[model samples]
Target: MTDAELDLVFKALADPTRRRIIERLDDHPGQTLFEVCAATLAEDGSGLSRQTISQHLDILERAGLVRTARKGRTKIHTADLSPLRLVAGCWLGRFIQED
Candidate 1:
């Protein structure tokens, strides 16, 4: 990934709520807005409203972390793995020194 792409990914991940949303999508794979909101309440007990979760999802989508598909009238959101793995391999991989 390019630096700009990495920046976007990192920026999106900077928010705890967005990270939680990513985790939720990781576990659930594909979930509609309502399903995600329910999961957040069950796990965090934050009672975050659907609107708040929707906004978070929007940010994730913009950062190329979350992908959405239309199923009839509902939008199903899924986590994209390539960007996360790329970011980890790019930045976190530096920790492993090859002597």
Candidate 2:
């Protein structure tokens, strides 16, 4: 990933809500906006608005952390960890040595 793309990935993960959203999508892929909202509420009792979650989803999508697809009339979201794995392997992995 380019510096800008890495920046976007880091930025997207910088937020607590976005991280939680990523966690949600990771555990359960292909969830609609409403299902995401419901799961978030059920998990933490957070009263986050749908619009707020939608905005977070947008950020994740831009960072290549989340992917969205149309399921009939609804849009379902899934987590894509390639960028994260790339970052970990290419950037962070350099810091550690195999024993």
In the range 1-99, model 1's lDDT, one tens digit per residue, is 788888889899998888998988988887999999988888888978888999999989988899999989888999997888888798867876454
lDDT of 1 at 83: 87
RMSD of each predicted structure: 1.8, 1.4
Clashing pairs in model 2, backbone N/Cα/C closer than 3 A: none
- What are the runs in model 1 whose C-alpha is more than 4 Å off? 96-99
The positional error of residue 70 in candidate 1, measured at the CA in angstroms, is 1.1
Candidate of highest lDDT? 2
For model 2, the stretches where C-alpha displacement exceeds 4 angstroms are: none
Candidate 2: C-alpha RMSD after superposition: 1.4
- Give the lDDT of residue 10 in candidate 1: 88
**What are the models' TM-scores?**
0.86, 0.92
* lDDT of candidate 2 over 1-99, digit per residue (tens): 678988999999999889999998999999999999999899879999999999999999999999999999999999999999988877777786454
